[model samples]
Target: MRTAYRVETVRAAEAALMARLPDGALMQRAAAGLAGACATILGRVYGARVVVLAGSGDNGGDALYAGARLARRGAGVSAVLLGARAHEGGLAALTRAGGRVADDPFAVLARADLVLDGITGIGGRGGLRPDAVPVVRAARGSDAVVVAVDLPSGVAADTGAVDGEAVRADATVTFGAYKPGLLVDPAREYAGAVRLVDIGLGPHLPSVPELEALQHADVARLLPVPRVESDKYRRGVVGVVAGSARYPGAAVLAVAGALRGGAGAVRYVGPAGQAVLARYPETLVHAGPPGRAGRVQAWAIGPGLGDTPGVDEVLESDVPVLVDADGLRLLDPAAVRARTAPTLLTPHAGEAAALLGVARDDVEARRLDAVRELAARYGATVLLKGSTTLVADPRGDLPVRVNPTGTGWLATAGSGDVLSGLAGSLLAAGLAARDAASAAAYLHGLAARRAARGAPVAAHDVADALPGAWRDVIG
Candidate 1:
């Protein structure tokens, strides 16, 4: 798992590390890494025009020190100081290495090959400060390849919220570990590409992280593979309650995903049985209420079930349940809170906004807060789907899972239905609610990227690619 820590935690860790190290040792280590990254980006540092945007804080010091290193290697470096006071030691070092403070910030920025953004650090609360706004704008507008020092100037490091205008960097060279903002959006969008440079933060940090992303090894461990003695009855069965007369395609897509989600059997109950059977003839179809849909290890409710007639019945069952789409609309919070088994709720921004009685824009803006709030309120594992898919648990002991694999092309209809079925199947296969949700999201996004392949893809294409995605991960 790739983990991220909160600002306070990071600060404490840095302080602890600094206490053990020699005077100015940590900064030099950071500067060396930053300079190396800049040199790599510039290809040949010799005579390369490098511009550093320096502010008042340690971020500016880092940039200046890095600039000094680059200057010594024959790069023509200039510092466009935005703060009232500069790092005196860093300034002297840069001067000694043949770099100068820029007489014209804009002029130097306009023709620079690379621009290092040291305008703000993790401690910064809001957008760019007023004095540094013009300098940031000039750097952004320039042809220079912009690289943020730790994070983009205007993004919240812990919340991933952008209050106002922020620096949009081509790449971000982060120190130590990943921040929540770098993994989520709208801050994630600002940080184009992220590279982590370890500065020995691991020993100083705690075990529990604020956020985490599951990689292939993690997902593979969570997935259930068939055993020699395993049979259909032992492998687990997933019951899907979805679709209506008005939208039969939802059932088909849901069943399609469930079929490949490591579940040995899929029992579908809804008005769209004919549609489901037409697509997946192997599916066990039932045209009655979900109560009589035979025994199932887990249940996935509401994709296209317009009125959600049997939602209560499924929610009352002892088995784990996944609620999504129209089912989320008819849900009773009290009933969800009363459930004994695990419940996972999947909601897009609009649905989540409605549940929290807030604007969709608000939910979209603060996805981490929204997901946590919903998970607490509903007493269930909440998966907020968007550009960055987040899975939050109410217990709050585990770090919120951020899905790393996905493409913009996944913004298509019926994708959520596929995800619901897949996650529900994983739940039936005996993974914990958080693990099921995270693993399902990982595979779903990977499948979407595989199916799309830089082209427009339908929802069924993503469902069909699940096996390939699973194979890729396990391989």
Candidate 2:
């Protein structure tokens, strides 16, 4: 699983490593990796023009040391000093390697094949300093590939908040552990692709990780595996309270998703029986409220529920509830609060806004915060669906699950119903809210990726791909 930690956790990890080693050991390790990556990007070290945008802290020190390595290998290196005095040791190292400091601020950009943004790291707050902004802008305008030393300047390390201006990087080589900002949004938008440099801080980390992403393997392990003694009842029955005559396709999609969702049976409860029977004849369809639908191990609700009154019955059920689509729109937070069983809320940015009583743009801007806030407010586990799907639970530790497996094709219509069915089935089969949501997202994304395969795919095709995607994890 790909993981991320807060800035404070990073500093603590760095401190522990620094105490055990000789001075500057960690920074040297970081510089070596940074230099190697730069050499690869530039094709050759010799005669390559490299510009380092130097700042006040150790981040600049890392870039300077990397520049020194390149210069010693015959590259023409230049350090454009953004601070009055750069890291003393790093500046001296660069000069000793035959690197020159740019006498003119604008000259470095024109000749550079690559630019290193050492303007800020996790320690930095607010936006880029006025002096550094123009240089950052120039780097963006350049044809050269811009590589951020630790993180993109002006991006928040902890919250993924790009409150002010920031540098958009082609790549970021981060030291020790990943900052939470890289895994979340806004700041994530600036950071292109990320690579972690292991600086031996693994030993000093906490028992519960700060953030985590489920891979195919991890999701496979978390999924409920049927035993030799398992029966249909033991495997669990998923109750789907979805769709109306107005939008019968939702019920069909939900049942299609549940059939291959490892559930022994799918019990459909809604006004879309004809549609459900038409698409999936095996689904046991019932017409009326969720309470009247007989027994169920878990419940999936809200997709195509419309502005109807029956949804409240499903929301109030004792079974684990997976709320999505129209269910998200029609939810009564008070009823959700009074529910006895665990609830998982899956909402895209728009639905999330409605739940939080905020603007959709506001939810998207601070997705991490919005998800966490919703989980707390409703006392439920929230899966805020987006590029980086974030799962958080109220009354639990602060560890948030961020799904790394995502595709643009997931934006297609009726996609969420399939996800809800998958998650709800898992919950019925007995998994924690966090686990169910995370696993569902992982598999859902894998299915979408397989179905799309670089081309457009219909929602039904995505549902059809679930069995093969699940095999990727278990097999």
Candidate 3:
């Protein structure tokens, strides 16, 4: 699994490491790594034009030192000091290595091959200072590949919030460990690609991370595999209560995803039974509420369920339940909190906004906070669906799972319904709520990528591609 630490945790680790190391050894190690990354991006450093945007902290020192290294290698390096006071030692070193402070920052930025953004460090918040905005903008407009130091300046390292003007880098070279901002959006959107430079902070860091993203191997380990003695009942049945007369396709798509989600059988209860049977004849169909249906290990309700009456029935069941789409609307926090069984709620930004009584933009901007609050309020696991899907547990203590495998193409209609069914199937297969949600998201995204392959894909296309995605994970 890939992990990220909060800024405070990272700072503690850095301080611990610095105390044990020589006076300037830690900074030197960071500068060396930064220079190496810049050189690789430039390909041949000899004739490259490098511009270093230096601010008033250790962040500026790292950039200045890196500029010095590039200058010594025959590159023309210029430093644009944005703060009142730059790192004194780093400035002296750069000057000694044939690097000069720029007379006009814009003049050099226009001809730069690469711009090293060291304006604000991870600790700096509320975006860029007023004085540095235009210079940063000029660097961005230039042909140079903007590589942010540690983080893209202005974004909150812990929350992933880009409140104001922030550096939009072509790539970000982060030090020590991954910050939550680098992995989550809208800050993630600003950080195009991320490269981590190890400064040996791992030994000093805590065991549990602030955030975690599952990899292919991790997903493979969590996926359900039937044993030789396993039967349809033993593998587990997933009850799906979805689709109304207006949206029968939601039922079909949900069932499609459930069947491919390693579930033994799918018992569907809704008005769309005929439509579901037309597409998937093997599904055991029922005409009434989910409680009246035969035994199921888990229940998934609310996809395209316009005016559906079974939400309360599903919640009252002893088995685990997943609430999504229309089911999320008019949801009672008291009922969810009262449930003895595990409850998973899947909501997009808009749905999540409604649940929290906030603007959709707020939910999208501060996704991590929104997901956590929703999870805590409902006392259930929440899988906030978006470009970066986040799975937060009810207690709010465990690390939120950030799904890394997804394309923009996965935003099509009914895609979320497919995801809800897949996650519910995993829940029925005996996985914990957090594990089920994370694993399902990983597979769902991988399937979408496989189906789309750069073309437009329907919700059913993603469902059809699940088997291939599963094979790819296990293989």
Every model's TM-score: 0.99, 0.96, 0.99
Q: Model 1 misses residue 465 by how many Å?
A: 0.7
Q: Candidate 3's residue-wise lDDT over 91-121, tens digit each?
A: 9999999999999999999999999999887
Q: Write the per-residue lDDT of candidate 1 for residues 1-475, one digit (tens) a residue.
A: 8999999999999999999999888888888999999999999999899999988888888999999999999999999988888988788899999999999988999899999998887878889888788888888888889999989988999999999878999999989889999999889999988888899999988899999999999999999998999988688999999999999999999998899898889999999998898889999999879989899999999999998598899999999999999999978899999999999999999999999999999998999999999999999999999999999998978799999998899899999999999999998888888999999999999999999999999999999999999999999
Encode model 2's per-residue lDDT on 185-302: one tens digit a residue.
8888788889887878888887677788778788877888899999988999999988887988888888888877777889999889998998788889988677877789889888
Q: lDDT of all the models against the reference?
A: 0.92, 0.87, 0.94
Global Cα lDDT for candidate 2? 0.87
Which segments of model 2 are wrong by more than 4 Å? Answer: none
Backbone clash count, each prediction separately: 0, 1, 0
Residue 156: error of model 1 in Å?
A: 0.3
- Worst 10-residue lDDT window for candidate 1 reads 119-128
Could you tell me how far off, in angstroms, the CA of residue 327 lies in candidate 1 after the best superposition?
0.4
Q: Which candidate comes out best when scored by lDDT?
A: 3
